[model samples]
Target: MRLAILAAYAAVISTATASYAQQSADPSGVWLRDDGNARVRIAPCGSNICATNLWIRDTSKGEEAGDRLVMSLEPKSPDTLAGTAYDAKRDRTYSITVQVSDRSLLTRGCILGGVLCRNVHWQLAR
Candidate 1:
């Protein structure tokens, strides 16, 4: 009986740890841009994932007032997401890949039909 109880407890603890790890691995929260100018909230849409501008430092710029779709991402791999990222201010769209981690978000946006690519890192906000 004692052995069975011990095994059950171990299973419960292992399951709980796995659940926590999975939740932490998911990047579904507000993240601060590396430039320190904006915060974006990432969440699931109808069938895909999207990130919208939640807040911005400059109000006069008319950036954060409207819910802007900055990123439309779909899972491509275990740790990578592929989609398009739009820059409303510049009216530009680029192919983007996002690599998500527990504390950081690394995104690479490609322009000119993949001729040019730029990387940006965003820190996960509490």
Candidate 2:
């Protein structure tokens, strides 16, 4: 029937729209470190997002340095993202905030209880 055909078309359109929305909202990709010594792979994990260590210049240190770091990103604005990095080795979580510009990301990590912190600006890899 015409009604059934229209319903099917609507369902298809809705599904396609939802898929596109998800892809567009995700900033999942491989990003390079500011020093050009490391790379991190960002992707959606479960209902949150995560960044995994992908590559590093120093092979000996890379093996132990790069591990899976789970974090959650909350968009503070259209260009700013705030989150926390759970360091399993240290058994502590660091507060992090990032300002994204096109393919570049300027990130800052701070000690949860103190003022000592570090910042790194990274670029997105093709």
Give the best candidate by TM-score.
2
Flag regions of model 1 displaced more than 4 Å.
Answer: 1-25, 59-62, 70-72, 86-92
Candidate 2 lDDT trough over 10 residues, lowest sum: 19-28
Any idea what lDDT model 1 has? 0.79
lDDT of each: 0.79, 0.75
Residue-level lDDT of model 2, residues 1-126, one tens digit each, is 999999999999999877655544344688898877779987888866677778777756434435776777776666777778776755778888867777887878889464988989878898
TM-score, every prediction: 0.65, 0.70
- Model 2 residue runs over 4 Å out of place are 1-26, 59-66, 112-114
Q: What is the Cα-based lDDT of residue 4 in candidate 1? A: 100
RMSD of 2: 7.1
Residue pairs whose backbone atoms clash in candidate 2: none
- Report the C-alpha lDDT of model 1 over 1-126, residue by residue, as the tens digit: 999999999999999877654543356789998989889888876665667887889867667644555666666666787889777667988898889887999988899999999888999898
